[model samples]
Target: MKTDTLFKRAFNDALLLTSRLRDGDPIPSETTLAAELGVSRTTVRKILQTLTEQGVVAGAGRSRFARASAGEVQPFPEAETVPTSVQVEKQFMEWMLRGDAKAGALINELDLARQFKVATTVIREFLNSFQRFGLIERRPSGGWVLQGFTHSFALELFEIREMFELRSAREFSSLPGTSPLWHELRRLRQEHIELLSEIETRFQDFSDLDSRFHRLVNTAVPNRFIDGFFDIITLIFHYHYQWNKKDERERNEVAIREHLAYIDALLSRSRSAVATACRRHLASARQTLIRSTSDTGSVA
Candidate 1:
């Protein structure tokens, strides 16, 4: 399955490169193509062989040339290129975020597999991994049950989250101007601004953007442990957003503004400013999560 995914991705990339060439343009050499496509020469050779068979390219070895015009070559379908595990994870997260599964809800592997259109084994494995976080548990009768966020869970999670994020934010502020992360940070800041402009109708969109912004901050100083913890953070916050709908638009708007302040602090390269902004935003988020969980009777 891994090899098939790699080949399909490379094949799609080769198709894209081919589409850019004139009908008779010489194909790049195996080494150059491999480097450009980030694949092994063997994979590149396979791609060239397949392209030749499909009449997309002509000739053999170093003598290859394009035979198809830009309009003629078709890339693989987008869905075919994504790994099955990724597809399952995305679908499962979407299911949770859509509030299809409430806190403490029973999770049936067969039902989720059917709902997600994947093998039941896939769902089982995903749940098993997720179970380690204490968010879910196995039942003796069969199936798993969600352990919804409670006030204590919110406090504990935020305690670690704050430590990780503050360290990352400080690291981010000290990044050299040439770092590409600066460019990404700028791009996300603009996205926050745009989302804030349409906050009333686009409020739901903030969940994704919120996740991206924090994830980017952590990239400044990557820690595998922090990275893993973020998976839980992302899921729980997504659940929080879905489960707590009171003043949803207003709440999101405030968060967006706080994010802008945080971004400005990072961009300023002021360590003190970064710390202040980070603390303020995290404090607000902690309170929000605690308040929401406290009000929800479902939490245990």
Candidate 2:
């Protein structure tokens, strides 16, 4: 399909799956979103025209489109966490649960792209990824609508992490009473501890390393099953917890410290210590999840 048509399909499909909403759904102009989505104004206009032609939305003064009906989705308020793509989608899901129909408000694409500091195509691609997940549905008249609960999705992600991480924690601690890996584990643990000793409150590291840290530890077991188990865990984190921007903190040094403690527990060959450290780490992660409830109340 032509690039012009591709964006229209994405935009319209997103509308169909999502319901109507109330205040603060900044549905803007085609001219603007066209730039935001990185397509031509003609392309965006085509999307608006298509939606207008359909009964889903009505044009507002030839500039914007008001929904044919504003329905009942509420908002899920959250703060900045791992602000990645997954978090964006979770934000949208929360809006759906509130029955907040305002999610369809068009954003200034140029502004959005600028704020994200990324090309519009990346944003568009992120939105498009949701389609395969069945999170979004297309309208006959040509618009998209969100169809899932945001909180439920977020919770589901956490539950899955708990199951995988707990088991991986056990395997990680299964090293021999005296293995060379123990020394390496000791070094990383000490550093992790010193940082944690000076701990404060909320902190987040918006890097793949945060993820790689877990993977590296679990993979240390050198068993196919252990590796496979965490591969599943990794997939969930990749898709569900993908965040956009991380909230800044004064003491993220604590997490690195905890990670080292976890390493120490594993090297000591003490299952209890390993599990305790893992639980502590996961608890902190859960707090981050809770705090990440987006106040802006938009989703991927």
Candidate 3:
């Protein structure tokens, strides 16, 4: 059988077994269970092992098996995990970081609660912590809003990021311990090029490339703080860089070429060339954004 099919069967069998047994129902013998499920003994063993790990069932000596006790609903099995508040906040945070979270569209404590399937109180506390991180805000209306960055914010972000990259390239290019940052940048730049070639849809593709390229650039920087800059920069770019909607393709290709140049300069240790490339790259985005804003008028 195809691995996909086998895995599906194994999963479905486990789910069926889980549903069939009542709370505290006696577990069946492995052989009987395997035969009944129409699966091989080894497959049954693997399934049972997985169930045991999930806290759904347990066993004892001489092949005895039993249902999970009410207390057995532990933190949750790896497969059936209930995402932590942090994890839920993280999902909401991504949208705030890169999404256009208008007043009506903003994610709040209630949204997080529904999204994570946890209590509203948990989400509220977590969102307050995000506000402390400067990632979100609560409105006077009892609704919460996500604070996004501006174009100037993006410029400052990239500037800080470049400083980190310049230092990392200088240090790691000649060092022995840490991984070469330039190499990773080159790989991601290549991936950006590939994405450009493969995608034809407009904003969505650009959005994806925008995210990936910035991440790649940030990776060149050694500091995590610098890496965090991209998180904010993405929001700024998406909100401000309108680019006439028609220029998306050309804009992306030009970006790809410039990124390639940036990576080349970093690899070759050409500081002047890197600085020049970065300037032109940013200027292009600025020009496009300004043009788009002018076109957009009060519609903005």
- Best by the lDDT measure: 1
Of candidates 3 and 1, the better by TM-score: 1
Model 2, 1-300: lDDT tens digits are 112335544454436433443332446666656666666776666666665565445646554545636543222223322335654545444434344544334433354456555566655666566555434555566445554424454466567667677776686677565656556556555544544554443233322445666765666555675566555445434433444235434325545666767776776768889889888977776665555433333333
Model 2 lDDT on a 0 to 1 scale: 0.54
Question: What TM-score does model 3 achieve against the real structure?
Answer: 0.48
TM-scores of the candidates in the order shown: 0.68, 0.43, 0.48
How far residue 129's Cα lies from its native spot in candidate 1, in Å, is 3.4
Candidate 2, TM-score vs. the true structure?
0.43
Best by TM-score: 1
| Model 1 agreement with the true structure over 138-168: per-residue lDDT tens digits | 8898789876455666788899999999999
- Give the root-mean-square deviation of each candidate in angstroms: 5.2, 17.8, 11.4
Clashes of 2: 47
Give the higher-lDDT candidate: 2 or 3. Answer: 3
RMSD of candidate 2 to true structure, Å: 17.8
Q: Worst 10-residue stretch by lDDT in candidate 3?
A: 291-300
